[model samples]
Structure formats: C-alpha cells, structure tokens
Target: MEEAADGDWVVRPITGAATGKTYRCPGCDQEIRPGTPHVVAWPAYVRDSDLDPWDVDSAADRRRHWHTACWRSRDRRR
Candidate 1:
C-alpha cells in the first residue's frame, strides 16, 4: 500500500457526486467509510465496457475492488 498523504486519507464517498469528499453509494444507498468495507456498483469504462477500475467524471474516479464474496456474486450474475 502506498503511504497515505496527510490530506489523502479521507472518509469521502467513492462516487463523483456530492461536494468535497462525500458521496452516496448506489448499492447500499449509504455513505462510504474510508476505513471500512463498503459495496459499490459502478458502470464499465467507456473504452472497455467489460473492464474494472473505471474512470468517472466525478469528484474522484471510481475504481472496482471486489471482496471475496462480492467477487463471487459478480461471477454468478454474469
């Protein structure tokens, strides 16, 4: 893991919506805690619609990181 800068680690939302570092999760309809595990649903990147780690036009670019259970659920849905 890269060293977190002084202003780097924040409890902001992952999506680009909301001002500053706050965002609402589309999956759980709740706020995202930086230190906790939260579920997020993101659209595929425009370039490769099947790829993960997509760039968003929000406050921050949203990327995909699948937990073990989340990964399994994703596979089953495919």
Candidate 2:
C-alpha cells in the first residue's frame, strides 16, 4: 500500500493481469477496461477515527479504482 501525498488515502497498484473486471474512474469518470493496469484507493483509516476504520466492510465499501495517470493528477483536477 502507498500513501497519498496529501495523506488522505491508501493506494494499491493493480496489475493488468490481475484486473478482470471493468471499473469507472472517479477522477475522470471513464471506464477502466479489463486487463488494464490501475490503482485501488480507499480513505486512510486513522487510529480511533469516527468512521470506524477497523471495520472491513466500511473500508471495502469506500474503495475505488482509478487509472494510474488520473490518480497521479487527482489533486489538479477540478
């Protein structure tokens, strides 16, 4: 897992070979096709956070897939 520069998220790279389903990128609102390399990111779970960071269901529900470039430039987009 990689931390976002802003410390707001935890990101994980997904290999092309591992991506079997399509996903819509929240950044660009475009389709991430199957077999495409991408990233999966979820909110950073701080200790004793109000969102119940330890809850696996909460974290899984918040996970989003993003294109590598879109994720890299996320802060710059409107």
Instruction: State the lDDT of candidate 1 residue by residue for 1-78, as single tens digits.
Output: 112221221222233232234444433345544454433333332334323465545422444433324433443544
- Residue lDDT tens for model 2, 1-78: 556655667788999999889999999999999999999998776434535645554555578999999998998996
Alpha-carbon RMSD, each predicted model? 11.0, 3.6
Q: Candidate 2 — what's its lDDT? A: 0.82
Clashes of each: 3, 0
Error of 1 at 28 (Å): 2.4
Model 1 weakest lDDT span, ten residues long? 1-10
Give TM-scores for every candidate, taking all chains together and pairing residue i with residue i. Answer: 0.25, 0.75
What's the lDDT of the predicted structure labeled candidate 1?
A: 0.36
